[model samples]
Target: MSETNGAWTWRLEDTSGTVVPVSEEYADQHFASQGDAESWVGEFWRELAEQGVVAVTLFELDRQVYGPMRLDTN
Candidate 1:
């Protein structure tokens, strides 16, 4: 079953674990399913990394599914 928008989202952060401020237009970065969220991150992670986002955490509402996954390709 799929969750509502904002139910499945990511918490982007830098290497120091500081939350990265997302632009207002990108604030609604929600997904219906985990796969959808993962795919979106896979596609845009490079751009995010470029913007100083070194890691990301997946969330289901207030629940953390998994992550703080490093964006480093090394």
Candidate 2:
């Protein structure tokens, strides 16, 4: 898993910790509120499953802005 800019990328790993092919768009669309995006993710997952992939586990990494803020009153 890796994060760059404001995008996050995640990959599915096997029990032995091996990287497997998982669609980033799928993950995004899986959580997306858009109907088209959700459909796309569904297709992606279907394709992956057709390739004899079963019982895959997802690992995720997220990045966000965090800082301290201070206010001054005049």
Candidate 3:
């Protein structure tokens, strides 16, 4: 994963070993960088946790943003 200009626009393999984008909108918003978006995502998750959301999964694809990406119970 690589970032440019404090924006996150990289692909990472999830636990499933699938490579995907952190977020498409973020990529576009940040000019295909991979820092700012990641930071935001971290915060987003944190907020969800604070809201009592138990499980969350974030998914992506090569330049494709696909999720929260999934949520699980138990």
Candidate 4:
């Protein structure tokens, strides 16, 4: 994950801790703000569920923001 100039890059991973290949729409995109990054997950997590992703993590450069948050597509 990388954050620069108040933007962020995200990584999606599986439960086994392997990085999953996110589609271009969600890959390598820099978010405008931390809240924006988190909101992206909030809205897009169902897609992650469909892709067999069990959890998510947020980072800002080298710092962990939150997560490995379990997906609940109920």
Q: Using lDDT as the measure, which candidate wins?
A: 1
**lDDT tens digits, residue span 3-57, model 2:** 2332322233343445456555333322222343334434455565443334333
Q: What is the lDDT of residue 59 in candidate 2?
A: 22
Sorted by lDDT (best first), the order is: 1, 4, 3, 2
Superposed Cα RMSD, model 3: 9.0
Error of 3 at 68 (Å): 7.0
Report the lDDT of model 1 for residue 33. Answer: 81
lDDT of 3 by residue, 1-74 (tens): 23334333323334454543444433333324334455655655544434344333332324354443432333
Top candidate on TM-score is 1
Cα lDDT of candidate 4 equals 0.72
Number of clashing pairs, model 1? 0
The models' CA-based lDDT, in order, is 0.81, 0.35, 0.39, 0.72
| Candidate 1 lDDT by residue in tens digits, 2-58 | 234447998899878888986654445888888888988898888888777899999
Worst 10 residues of 4 by lDDT: 1-10
After superposition of all CA atoms, the RMSD between model 4 and the true structure is: 3.2
Please count the clashing residue pairs in each candidate, in the order shown. 0, 0, 14, 0
Q: Give per-model TM-scores.
A: 0.84, 0.30, 0.27, 0.76
TM-score of predicted structure 3:
0.27
RMSD of each: 3.3, 15.1, 9.0, 3.2
**Scored by Cα lDDT, where does model 2 land?**
0.35
